[model samples]
Structures are given as C-alpha cells and as structure tokens.
Target: MTIRPLPDTLVNQIAAGEVVERPASVVKELVENALDAGGTRIDIDLEEGGVRLIRIRDNGGGMPGDELPLAVSRHATSKIASLDDLEGVATLGFRGEALPSIASVSRFSISSRRTDDDHGHVLEIDGGRVGDVVPTAHPEGTTVEVRDLFFNVPARRKFLRAERTELGHIEDWLRQLALARPDVELRVSHNGKVSRRWKGESDLLSGMRLHEALGEAFRDAALRVDHAAAGLRLHGWIAQPAYNRASTDQQYLFVNGRAVRDRSVAHAVRQAYADVLFHGRHPAYVLFLELDPRRVDVNVHPAKHEVRFRDVRLIHDFVYRTLHEALAGTRAGTPSGAGVMPADNGPAPSPASPGIGGMTSASGYMPQAPLGLQVAETRAGYAALYGGLPAQATHDASTVAGPPQALPDSGDATLPPLGYALAQLHGIYILAQTAEGLVVVDMHAAHERIGYEKLKCAHDGEGLRTQPLLVPSSLAVSEREADVAEREAATLAELGFEVTRSGPQSLALRSVPALLAHGDVEALLRDVLADLREHGESRRVAAARDELLATMACHGAVRANRRLTLPEMNALLREMEATERSGQCNHGRPTWARFSLPEIDRWFLRGR
Candidate 1:
C-alpha cells in the first residue's frame, strides 16, 4: 500500500475518537466553545445522557453566515494564529478539533447570527456530510443541536455507560467549570427537566456558589489561601486537616483557570500535609495557580488534562510551603480567626479565636508566627517521652497548692484557644473551660504532636546523624543503579547515607541514618535510587527519618491513664498553645475539640 492522505471525514472521525469519548466529553467541548465565545448564560439540554440529543444555547457573539461552514472545518479556530500564539494560548477551546470531530461522529446542527448579521443561518451535517447553509430565524447568539451521537460508530456507541453514570460525568465536569468561572451563569436540564443551575456571582468564588459547587461541609471548614510570591499566584480554599475526605475527589487544582491533574502538583500537596493528615486519608482543596503563560505548556495532550511546567521544582516547593504555612497551627487548638460555618442547618456561626498573650483576638492571630519558637534545646529531652517520661518535669506535691484554678468567664478576656485545663477526665481527656465555651483534649495525641514537632526541629537543627555499620554491607544492582548510586553520592551523604560504588554493578553501603538503623537498608537504598532517577530528588530518606521520629513521639508522649495533678494539666495546656499543629497528633487524629457556648446550650435548650 502506498502512503495516502486520509479524507477529511475519516480524519475527523479519528479525532472524535479522542476528543469525544462519551456524552460528557462532547458536553465539555461544547460548553468550552460557548465559554470561549464569551457566553455569559449557557443553557445545556441533554437527553438519554446526551446520547440522543445535546442542545446547547449560548447568548455569545455568534458567527456570521459566511463562517458557518468554516465552523465544521478541521483546524479552523479563532483562538490562535501562529506558533507564538499557540505557546501562550489561554482559551478553553483552541485546538479547533472539537467541532468537526463531533460533527463527523453524529448528526450536528449549528445555527447562529452574529450581532451584525441580518438573520440567523443553520448548517446541518450528517456524519461529516456538509449540508447547504440556509437562512433561519433571527438570533443574536448560537444554538448547537447534536442528535444521535456516535450513530456512525457502533463501537463508540457501545462503549457508552448507563444514562445515570454518563450524566454524572457531565455534572462533575460542569461543577469543575463552575469553580473556575464563577462569573459565568450555567444551567443544565436532563430529560426535559431542569436539574441544576449555577447563578453567576462575582469574579471571586466563595459563599453560596462555593458551597453549592463543592459542599457546605467543605466551605465551613475551609481556610482562604491567597499567596503571591516567586512570580506565581496561588489562591483558593483549603479545608482543615480534620475535615478531610477518603479520596482526592474534592481537590480541584486549576492552572491558569484550566483544571488539570499533574503528578508534580499532587505530590507537592501530599508532601505539604505529610506530617499533619491522618494515614489513609486525602485532603480537599480548590486551588488555582496563576503564572506567566510561557512558563507552562497546555497543548501537551489532546484532552488538555495535563501540563508541563518550565520550573516544576519551583512550583512544587511553592505549593508545599504555602499550604504548610496555612496549616501550621490549625490543629494546635489555637484560637484562630478561621471562618467556620454551622455544620448543620441550625444557624451560621463564627470560630472564637483565642487571643494570645493578652493580645486582641482580631489583630493578634498570625498563622505564620512560631507556636513553640522558643530558643531552648528542643531535642535534648524531646524523645524522653518516647521512653515513658513526662514531656515536662512532673509537678511536685506543693505545685497543686489547693484545687484547679477556675477559668475566667469575664474581665480577663484574652484567653488562650485551648483555655486552662480544669481536670483530667478518665486519665485520658483534659477537660477545660474557655471564654468561648469548653475544650476537651486528648492528652496523648496532643503531647504526641508537641513531642513530634520538637523531635523534628531538633533533627533539622542538627544535621542527620549517620550510624556506621561495622560490616559495611555490599549490595548488587544494575549498571544504571550503580551509576545513580555513584552520581547521587553527595545527595545520599546529605540524607545520612554513605554509599560507594564498589564494582561495575555493585555498591557498598558504609553507613545509614541513625534513625533508620533498623530498617531494611538495601531495599531503602533501591527505593531512593529509583526516586532520584525519576523525581530528581529523593523524599524516601526524609520520610523514613520522619517515620522513626513519629514512632518515638508516639511512645514518648503522655500515656493515657496516667494520673496528673492540676499544675501538670495546666502546664500541658500552656505547652499545647506554644506548640504548632497541636490540633492533631502526628498521625492526623484530632487532638482537641471546642464546644462553643451555643453548642453546649443547644444540648440543654437554654432559651427554649
């Protein structure tokens, strides 16, 4: 067979195979087109999950009669003109492959009349067979009707899922779009009944729109993150670690207003929450990254769901550091000005921020401030608790004096977030009274976080400690692995591993990090090498060190059932206030909870 040029119809059908996977994909393409056309109000009608019919009407700047035919022609778009334009393309639909692709796979009709045209015109196409453009009714916008989708391709039709499942996909994509463009009004109808509507709000995404798009739960527990530094702007809402989900379904990351799934971004987020979140749980966030268009590539894939950044490491570090600062003391039980709505439909309420050191609550709380930023030898006695020792010295018999001091309800208004500990309940919970309400703390978990943070600080202050092995274990590996071992020797040394290439495909591990002395050294080295080869850096070594420190903190923290006097209890409360991330333990379990006065009053029907 000779090299032959494919016909336009067949070529479009092939593109459709990628651009239009299901009704949802078609809906995405059409809605994006409408958005690019400056549509403020878009109405989408679907039948049988958009298989039978998908009609989208947008009050946008419609095309003239002359452009109706060009609309279905492949590679024809108003978004970009040249290679330089392609590099900085910002519109949602720029490839110009969606229109012709969908038209070739189904019976498509595009009727439109520009603001300047005298009347509307309709162009019909059956499986890429173009029809004559005829004059139609007057209209100042475009209305596209797609019927019998995938009728020409039986295989494509068979791959479609159930109506409900397909509808779910469409709804999910619409919700994502709603998040990015809160200024665009969107309405959806399925099976002839209006199912959902998102009213356009201000340019910012928050309040009712955010709650409707994500959920009320996420909105209530969200923290506003607006940080611009290092030539990038990251702004969005990040939920508290306590209010996490089982999966990353709620994490909506938008790069220049386009939703994408980039591994580097995801990994950065994961690393940011590494020390705070519980194991086996995921975070919920709606973040948007805005940067120079030239620094990122959006035309890497046909679906445009992935992107390549010019400075991936810089992006990773920025996202990680920003989120880390936001969550610094969120779990530490600090009286923060974090906005929290009512969990139920009862009524909206605000969080009572505990003012520190007699400072005004409104003007006092700073997330970036050091919680336990004292200039003490943090690690000298930090791990003593891991050995069943108290985090602080045990209170002497004279320390208790009389009974637990009563917390002030008035007069002394600058109360700490955790308040003063009144008593230890059941040798586990430290019950205290705060100016806002009551606070119950899991002593073990709280101390664990405190001790863990100190241990980490100490570990960082003093560089990694290397434990030399007497035997100097030798391991066999591939030539590539051996090359990596030799190349990354300096990086390995920084991570407290001294590795030397012994032979063509062998390495000698002379020492390892003291914290990971008992771990499987050979396996750990292999994993590190693989990480370095892929990510240009290895987190496994740091992760291993942190894991060891966590275990030490867990064992060293105050044990449940250990009786404590009033002074010891109060001392613990003060330490918690001074410690960062005291809201949860090292493993992500919440360390404390505050029950506002109204919450406690509701239990007893105070007013009613």
Candidate 2:
C-alpha cells in the first residue's frame, strides 16, 4: 500500500481525539487560551455541559482582524514564533492545536479586537469550514463561542455522558483555573444558573472563596501551606488533618501557574504528614511549585500537563523536608510565646505534637494555630513556669502515678512460675511465658495488621456495601481526575461510591462505602480522589488503596491509648493469633517482639 496524505477533516478528527476529549477538555483549552492572551477577567457560560453551547469572554489583548480567520486555522498560534522560544516558554499554553481541533467537532466562532481597533471582527467555523468574516461590536478582548460539539461525529457524540456528568467536569475545570490564578476574576454560568466565580488577587486565602461557591464542607477541610527554599518555592493550601474526603475532587496542583499532575510532589506532602494521619484519609491541597523555567520541562505531553524536572530527586527532597519541617516543630514561622525554661533539659515531647504544652484534655494533644501555621514551641523552662508539671519531678507523674491497672486472674489464666508466666508492661505491650522463654507484643501494631487483612479480604470478596447519602455531595475536580473516576467507575462502584459526573468540572456523590458507617462520605470521597489525582500515576493506585484501607482500619480498630478490659484484650490476642501475618501492622512495622526468660533474668541481675 502506498502512503497518502490524510484529508483536513479526517486530520482534525484525529486531533480532536487527543485534544477534545470531553466538554471539560474544550473548556480547558479555551480557558488556557484566554489566560495566555493576558486576560485579567474571564467569563464562561455553558449549556448542557457545553454539549449544546459554550461561550467564553475575556478581558485581555485581542487579535487583529486579519488574525481572526487564522484563529480557526490549523497550527496557527502567536504563542511561539520559532523553536528557540520553546526553551523559555513561560505562558500557560503554547500549543496551537486547540482551536482547530475544537472547531473540527463543534460549530465555532471567535470575535476579537485589539485595544487600538475601532470595533471587533467575528469569524466563524462550521465543522472546520470557515464562515465569512463579519464586523461586530465588542470590547478590546476576545469572545469565543462553541456550539453543537461532536455533532458531525456521531460516534464521539454517542460517548458523551449524562448532562450532570458533563456539568461536573466543567465545574471542576473552572474552579482549578480560578485557584491557579486568583489574580484573575472568573465567573461561570451553566444554563443560566450561576455556578461559580472568583476574584483575581495574589492573596493566599482567595482560594477559600471556593468554600462559598462549592460549600462549607469543602472549606472546613481546606488548609493553607506556603514555604520558600533555595531556588524552589512552594505555596498552596491543604485540608486540615481531620478534614479528608474519599475522592480527589479537592486537590489542585500547579507548576508555575499551569495545572499539573505530579505525584512526586504530592507523595512528599503525604509522607510529611504520615505519622499523624490515618490511611485512606487524604490531605486536600492546592499546591503551587515555582522554580526557574530552565529547570523544568513542560513539553512532555501534547496537553502540557505532565512535566519533567531537571532535578526531581532534589525537588522531592525539598518538598518533603519543607512540608515535614513546617508541620513538625523544626521550623518556626512565629516566635515562641513566653514560658518557663527548663533549668537544663527534659525528655522530648511526643513526636506527633510538639510545642503544644499543658494538656487541656487527658489525651495531651493540642491543636495547631488557627491559620495552619506551626504552633510556637514552649521553651525548656516553660513547663515549670506554666506550672504544667511540678518542678520537683521533671516527668509527668500522671504517666505512672498509680499502680498499673489490674487485670483479672481467673481460672482461664495460667502461669508457669519458674519465672513469671506473663507480664504486661505499661498497659501498652504484653509479655507471655513460653517454654523457650518469653514473647512481647505491641497490641496496637498487632491489631492494626489483623484489621487491615480483614478489610482487604472483605473488599475483595464482597464489594464494598454502599450507604446512600441523604443529600448529594458536590465537588470540583480536574479533568484528568474525572477521567480516572470514569475509568475506575466500576471499581469505585464496588467500593460503594455511586459517583456520576455532574458537569465539566464537578462530581456528585450519591452514596459511599457502607463500612464507613459514621464517616463523612463526601469528605472521604474528596480526599481519596485528591490523593489518587495527585499521586496515582507515580505511586501504585493499589498502594494508595491500601493506604485508604489503613485509614479505615485505624478508625475502626481500637486506639493505642485506649485502655481495654480483659475480654477485649483476650479477643485481640485471639484475633492476632488467627491472623496470617500478625507480626506486623499494615504499614509494615513489627507488631510483636520476643525476649527469653534468661534475658529478663539478666536484666534483674539473676545472671551477669
């Protein structure tokens, strides 16, 4: 067979396959074009998830009358003049494939006027055929209208989802763009119903406006994170530790103002908060990474969403260290409040919460600052001065003030007393007498492992039981995330998530895993999807799912600090014994360790 050139229409349909995936893809390309044109404000109006109509108007530098026709021409762009410009590309978008690709599948119209022009000129394209250019009155910017998307291609049109699903996509796209450029005023309307809007500003808190647009549940989980390091700057907000959702709807990531899906950065964030947070419960964040353009490559994909950093290891380390240091008490943004100094030194506070002194509750934990800033550590002498602990004894007497809580010694109990048959220490670990010597068990670790396996097996055997949500939970999500959700819809359904796309940028939750009986299903879905969206590709999706299981196991299992009665303890022991891999927890830490009778005797000076 001889090779032949493809027809223009066929060429465009193929391009549409790559560039025009859904209603949201069209929105993304159009929005990015508007932003690249130096738009300070953009308005998007959609009907029927942009399947019926889409209109975008921007207040930015417009195009010349002659350029109006070229705007719909294939490979036409003012973003790059030549190859050299690629090295220093700083704009959010540089590809010229968007307009033509979009117009091929939809009836398209573009009207524009330079600031110096008397009026605007409108050029139309009906399924890639150019309509006559006509004079039109308009502002010194650009307004693009797209109608009857995928009309000529019935196959593509058939794949179009429900109106609700398409609208959800649109909603997600708009909000993420709004978050990326808070300095630009954005307003979105669908079918004449107001959807969302954001004012342009540099203020970090501006993204919080999404709470009003999206809802209070979303706002509560939101947290703010910002820090700068050597040549690399990180700025964004995350949901509070307690605020996590099941889906990845709330996560937004940007690399120099262009939205991205980079797992290295997201994993670092998760690792930084690992110890304190449960699995499955993801931290929702809108993170921005800014470094020299020379150090990053944004040309990896046609969409330009995937990037290759020159020093990914360095980037990873920087993100992890900075996030961890900020969350931990290592780096202080604010001065420590006045407090007593230790005459010399004292044992370090629990690793999880530091700088938090004077237990208000018996748990000895304290909340962070209101703005999500690191809590200022109380100084060494601080405890004495604050009368938190008696000066005579540095250690908190309450830790071991009374006799150890007694355990029942009934006929069911047995002791082989050439030495103590078993001795439980600190009420946290258990020691059992054995013919060889003795065995030690970390109750928390052991139970966690057992619970994790049970959950995994149940998840495999019987799909997650879904509990219906009383009110539909709505959230904004990126298009890539939407694709993942759609692709994994079957799996998600098994997990008890009855999620249907509601817009080009949003998702609606109708149900959740029934096992999460008392959980905030909407929030859980958001967090799960956020984690998947941010870190899914780099890390194994299965591993992330494991983390989710860990989260559920942690919440459902008995806590480490909680005191248990004998029956509860015995039941835990039996469960651990029956468990296949009971030696370690789901996180891979040893659940139990053994010490022989001789070792215990030596510690008591029975042998030297």
Candidate 3:
C-alpha cells in the first residue's frame, strides 16, 4: 500500500481520539471555550451522565452566522494566528481542534446570535458529516448541543465507564473549574433535574465558594495565602497542618488560571509541610500560581492539564520559601485569625510579650530561678536517662538563662497562647486554662517539637557538616545524570555533598552530609541527582538531616509519666508559644487541642 493523505473526516476522527476521551472530556473542552468567550454565566444540562446528551449554554460573545462553518473547521481558531501568539496565549481554548474533534465523534449542533445580529444561526454535524448552516432563533449568546457522544465509534463508546462514574468525572472537572474561576456562575442539571449550582462571586477569593466546594471543615481550617515577588504571584487557601488528609484528592493547583498538575510545585508544598505533617498524611490546598505566559508552556498536554515551567528551580524555591515562612507562624497559641489554629469565641488574647529572662509575661507562672538554672538542674537527670544532652541542648542550656520575674494575673490580656499550666495529667498531658476554655497538651509531643526546632536552629547555625570517606565510592549513572551532577556541583556542595565526575557516565562521591554518613551513600547520590535533573534542585540531603534530627529530638524530649510542677510546665508552654511550627510534634501529630467554653458547656449541659 502506498502512503496517502488521510481524508478530512478520517483525520478529524483520529484527532477526536485524543480530545474526546469520555463525556467529561467533552465537558472540559466546551466549558473552557465558554470561559474564553468571556462567559459570566453557564448552564450545563446532561442526560445519561453526559453520555447520551450534553448541552452547554453560555451568555458570552457569540460568533456571527458567517463564522459558524469555519468555527467547526479544523485548525481554524481565533485564539492565535502565529507562533508568537501561541507562545503567550492567555485564553483557555486556543487549539481550535476541540470543536472539530468533538464534532466528529458525536452528533453536534451549535446555535448562536451576537448582540448586534438580527437573528441567530445554527450549524449541525453528524458523525463527521457537516450540514449546511440555517437561520434559527436564539438569545444573545451561544448554545452547543452534543448528543450520543462516541456514537460513531463503537470501540471508543465501549470504553466509557458507567453513567454514575462518567458523571462523577464531569462533576470533578466542574469543581476544578469552579475553584479557578469563582467569578463565573455555573448551573448543572442531570437528566432534567437540577444537580448543582455555583453562584457567581464578586470576590475571587470568597470563602463561601471554598466552603461550598470542600465543605465546612476545610473552609474553617483554610489559611489564606497571597504573596507576590520576582514576576510570580501565588494566592489561595491551604489547610492548616493539623487539618491534613489521607490522600491528595483535595490538592488543586492552577497556573495562570488553567488547572494543571506540576510536580515541582507539589513537591515544594510537601517539603514545606515536612516538619509538621504526619508521615502518611497529605495536605489540602487550592493554590493558583501566576507568572508571565512566556515563562510557562501550556501546550505540553493535549488535555491542557499540565504545563512546562521555564525555570523549575525558581518556581520550586519560591513556593517552598513562601509556604515555609507562612507555616512557621503555626506556632502554638496564635490567634485564630492569624492562620494557625482557630481561636475560641471571646476577645482574642494579645500575643505574649517578651518578659524578663526571655520568658513571656503571659505564662502566668513565675519560676524560682533563671531558665538556665532550671535546665542545669534537669541536665543531670536527662543525662542519666538518655546518655547526655545533645549539642543543641548544651548550646541552649547556656544562653536561655535570664533573671526571673513575677507572673502576670490570670485575667491579663497578654495571656500566652497556651495559657498557664494548671496541672499535669497522668504525667503525660498538661492541663491548662485560658479565657476561651481548656487546653490539653501532650507533654512528650510538645517537648519533641520544641527540641526539634532548637536542634534545627543549632544545626543551621553551625552549617552542614560533611564527612569525608576514606575510600571514594564510584557511582555509575546515565550520561544525562552525570552531566547534571557536574553542572550542579555547586548546589551539591551547599547541600553537604562532594561529588566529582570521574567518567562520561560516572561520579566519584568523596563525602556525604555528616548526618547521613551511616546511611546508603550511593543510593542517596542517585536520588539527589535524579531530583536535580528533573527539578533543578534536590532536598534529599535536607530531608535526611531533618529525619535524623527528629529522631534525636524524640529521644531527648521529656517522656510520659514524668511529673512536673506548675512553673516547669508553664516554662514549657512559653517555649512552645515562641517556637515555630510548634502546634504539632516532629512527627506531625498535634501537640495540643483547644476545647472552647461553648463546646464544653454543650458537653456537660451546663447552660440547660
């Protein structure tokens, strides 16, 4: 057989295979077209979970009668006309293939009337067969009807899931659109019965939309994030660390208003939460990253669900640093409105002010001596239990001591976030009182976080320690990996690695981070190289160091079943309030929980 150009219909059917995977795919394309047309309100009607019929009506700028035929033609798009236009596309639908591709696989009709037109016009297509355009009556907008999706292609039709499953996919896509475009109003009906409606919101960052989409709990736990720098802006809501999920179903990322999945940004978020999140838990977030269109390519995927960033390392670092700083305020006792934990009803207490000897006036308990003396008294006891104070403890024990002062009154406005410790519960938990109500703290968990933060500070101050290997280890890798290792040698050195390329596809690892010297050196190098090649940076070394430090802190922390006096407990509470990311322990478990007075009253029926 001789090679020949594929016929128009055949060519269209082939393209349909990529653009029309299922009914949900059809919805995505059409809805995106509506959004690009400046549609403020959209109505979606579906039957048989959009498998039998899908009609989308949008009150947007509509095309003229003459443009109807061309609108359904392949490669005929008004979104872009040249390579430069494609490079910096801002609209959602630019390929122009979505309309024709979708038309070829299903029975489709489009009716539209521009605001200035005397009448509307309609065009129809049946299984790749185009029909003549005819006059019709329509409102000042566009309405697209797609019927019997995949009817002409039995093989493709067979692959579609059950009605409920297909509808679920469509609903999920709509939810994503709703999040990205809160300004657009959307209404949906299934089999003639209304299913959902999202009213248009004037405020793009309205919490009502978040509550409607994710539920009340996430809305309440949401932390507003808005920061701009270096030609990039990231704004959205992130669930507090304590409100984590078991899966990543709630993670939503949009780049320049288009919903997409970017591994680098996702990894940055994960790293930001590494110090506070539980080992197996995932955080929930709805984030939008905005950068110059030239800096990102959205044409990478046919479905437009992925993008290629020009500077992966810059994006990663920016996201990581921004979120890292934001989460640092998760220190225990922050006001509810401050994005940490929610405060209970009543006047929000003022943040604790620095008091004598580095203690806060809000602690409400006066120690008998300087904080340093207290640590010295407990140093011998801790040494007897855990061998000796770690280097971090030794450093802190020397500097934290200051002259003691009188405690504040219980009703003072500057009450510490955790309040003054009332007593120890079973030697494991600290019971305290606040203006709001009760606060129960897991002593061991709280101390572990406190110690872990101190250890990190000490380690950072001293800089990363490198351990030289007596015999350099040789690592065989791909040529690309070797090239990346060589190019990123400076970055590697900053991460406590001393690697040099010995051959075209090999590396000589002379040293590793001192903290991870006992672990797998070659494997670690390979992982770091992989990250560098893909993300232009690597956090493997830092993650490993943090894990080791976490273990040491856990061992050094105060254990359960140990009694504590009011002053000792109060000191611990003050330290928690001052420490970063102290709301949770090193392992991500929340160190304390607040039980507001209203909730306690309901539990005991005190008001009744």
Candidate 4:
C-alpha cells in the first residue's frame, strides 16, 4: 500500500494513545491545564472511578468563545509559539496535545465564561467529532466534562484496571498535586459523595498541609529544608532517618512546581542518608528543586514526569551537599520541635526551636576537631580499645569523670537536650532525666554514631587513600562508558581511582580506593562508570569507604552488658549531644528515645 497522511481523527486517536493512558492520565492532564490557567480552586466530580464520567470545574481565567474550537485542535497551544519559547517553557500543559488527544478518545465538553464576557459558551466533541460552540450559562471559570473514557478504543479501554484501582491512581495523582500546590484548594467527589478535600492555605509550605496530606507521623518527623545558592533553590520536608520507610512510596520530588521523578535527585538523597539509613530502608522526603527553566528540559517525557538536566553533576552535588548538611544537625539531644503536635484546628506548628544548653547550638554547631584530636579528647576509651590491649580498656574507661553530685534542677537552668544521666540500665541503656521528661539511650548505638562521624571527619581531612594495583586491571566497557571514564579521569582520581582509556571501548584501572582494594575491582569500576555516564558523578567509592568506616566504628563502640559508672554514662550522653547525626546509629537505628512527663503520667495514671 502506498504511504499517505493519516486522517485528522486517526492522527488524534494516535496522539491520544500516548497521552491518555487511563482515567488517571486524563485527570492529570486536565488538572495541569487548570493549574496553568491560574486556578485557585478546583473541584472534581467522578463517577465509576472516573471511568464512566469525570467533570472538573476550576475557578481560573477562562478561554474566549472564539478560542474554544481552536483549543481542541492539534498543535494549537498558547503555552509556546517558537523554538525559544519551547526551550524555556514553564507551564505544566505546554504541549497542547492533551485537550485534542483526550477529546478524541472520549465524549468531552468544555464550558467557560471569562470574567468580562456577557455569557458563557460551550463546545462539545464526540469521539474525535467536533461540535459547534453554543451559548450557555456558567460561572466565571471553566468546566470540562469527559464521559466514556476510551469508549472509541476498546483495546485501550480493556487495559484499564478495576474502578477502585483507577480511582486510587487518580487519588494518588491528586495527592502529589496537593503537596506541590497547597495554595490551591482541591476538592474531590466520587460517585457524587465527597472523598477528599485540601483547603487552600496562604502559606504554601504550611505544616498543617503536610500533616493533612502525609499524616501526623511524617509531619512530626519532618525537617524543613530551605536553601538557595548558585542559581538554584531547594526547599521541602525530609523525614528524619529514624522515620525511614520500607519502600519509597512517600518520596515526592517537584522541580519548578512540577512533580517529576529524577534519578539524579533520588540518588543524591539516598547518598545523603547512606550513613544513617538502615540497609534496604528508604528515606521519605517531599522536596522541591527550583532552577532556571533553560537549565532543565521537561519535554523529554510525554507525560512530563521526567526531565533532562543541563548539568547533572552540579545538580547532584548541590542536592547531596544541602541535604547532607541539613541531616548533620540530627545530633542527639537537639530538640527539632518536629515532634510537637499542633492543637486541634490550630495554626501550623512553629519552626524548629533553637538549640538548648551551653553546649553547641544546632544552628552554629560545626564539628571542628580532626579525626585523632577530637576522638582522643572525647572518646579516649574507644580510641584505646582500637589501639591498646583489652586489659588497658578498664584503665582508659575510668578517665571520663562523673557529673557532680548536685545536678542543676530544670527550674533553675536550661538542661542539656539529653539531660543528666541517672544510671545505666542493664549496662546497655543510659537512663537520664531531661527538662521535659525521661531520656533513654542505647549506649552502643550512640557511641557507634559518634565514632563513625569522627572517623568520617578524619577520613575527609586526610583525603582518600589509593592502593596501586600490582597488575593494572583491564576491563572492556561500552564506548560511551569509556568516553566518560576518559573525560572524568580527574573526578575519578578525586574519588581514589586512577582510570585511563586503553582502547575505544576499554579502560585500565591502575589504582582504587584502598578501603575497597580487596572487593570486586572489576565490578566496582563497571558500576562507577555506569553512574558517571548517567549521573555525571558516582558515589560508589565514597559509599564503600563509609561502609568500612562504619564497621570500624561499630567494633570500637561500647558493647552491651558492659558495666558503666554514672560518670562514664553521663560523659557518653554529653558526647552524643555534640556529635553530628547522633540521633541514629551507623545502621540507622535510633540511638535514643524521649518519654515526656505527660506521656509517662498517662502510662502510670498519675494525673488521675
């Protein structure tokens, strides 16, 4: 058969295949359009889980009657007009294919009335057949109705899941939207009964909105992050390492107000939590990254759920460093104020409280000691354990002085976050009294974190140690990987690897990070090359180095069932307050937990 141009309806149906996957896809596109139109309030009414009918009304700037027909025409979009506009497009619905594509696959109607218009106009489309626009009465906004989704295409319709499943997808998308735009009011009704509602708030980053969307547990554990630098701004809430999840279901990332999935950002977050998160556990975060539109290409994916960054390395490093520094303040005894709950129907919780006591303030605390000096001063016993004989451990352990007999009362002074140690529980937990209540600490876990952090500081100060290969390892890789390895040789060297291109598609690894020298050098090189090629950087070397340091710290940490004096336990508590990321051990388990006076009172019925 001779090749010919596809008819308009067939062309539209084909485009629909790419944009209209299911009812949830339809909701995403239409809702995006509403947001782009400056909608402040959106109401969605769905029947049969949006499979039978979906009617969305938005209080936004409505289109003119004349443009109503053109709105459903292919490639007709007001979002972008030229190549330059396309390069820096910021709106969510710039492609303009959603309206026509969605119209072709379902029975659709759009009614709108601009604020200045005398009356409203409505346009209808039936399975790709356009109808004339007619006058109608409507509020000063826009309303879009879609029925019989995938009716014209039985194949696509058959692929749709059950009603409950489709509605779940729609609800999930709405939740993501609500997270990014707390300023927009969203209400949903399923089969005529209200299902969910997100009230608009003046503050976009309100903690109440977070609580409502993600639940109280996440809100209580969230650490607000807002930092701007180098033409990029990253702000959002990241759950504390102790509040990690088994899966990444709670991870939400939005770039420039658009929800998207970026592996580079995800990898950076994972790396930031590498030392504190338990193996196989995923950290939960709701982060928003803002950069110049020209620096990121959102048109890479049809659904606009993925993007291509102009400088992946710069982005990766920025995210990693910001989050890394933020998490460092997770030291034990720091009252983040994240655990405080707001009163019923009250204002959003206040920002995190400032540091307490004469110890280092959370905002100003920066570990200044290099490896040997700080460790020697604060943890001499652990150092002795690492170097000296086991018989000498007892002598070194006695060096830590006990607190004074007369401890300062909470009424008279601001106690340290962890308070004063009272006694040791079974030689494992350090029981202490705080201004608010009881503080229970896992001695081994707390010491492990302290030692791990100190070791990292020392390692960072001295730089990575490289072990030269007696016989250079030769590995064959893809041409792209080889090119990346050659281009990033200096970067590799910084990570303690000396890689050189041997052939068009081959590499020679002359040296590797000493910490991972015994591991699979070939596999390591391959993994590093893959990361570099995709993300413009790799953390495999650092991760491997940290693993070794973590093991060392674990062994050097105080073991359970070991006897400890009141002074020794108090000294350990003080060190925990000073150490960065001390709230969790090297394995991500929380090192301590606080039981406030009120909670304890309820447990014992003391108030009653």
lDDT of each: 0.79, 0.65, 0.82, 0.81
Instruction: Determine which window of 10 residues in candidate 2 has minimal summed lDDT.
Output: 331-340
TM-score of each: 0.88, 0.58, 0.91, 0.91
Please write out the lDDT profile of model 3 over residues 147-166, one tens digit for every residue. 99989899999999999999
Model 3: lDDT equals 0.82
Model 1 lDDT tens row, 347-461? 1111122211121222232222212212123345534323432344353445343544565563366666666667889999999888778899998888777667766666676
Model 3 spans with C-alpha error above 4 angstroms: 204-207, 337-411
List candidate 2 segments past 4 Å from native: 206-210, 213-223, 330-608
Top-down lDDT ranking: 3, 4, 1, 2
Candidate 3: 10-residue stretch with minimal lDDT: 373-382
Residue pairs in candidate 3 whose N, alpha carbon or C atoms collide under 3 angstroms: 336-343, 372-401
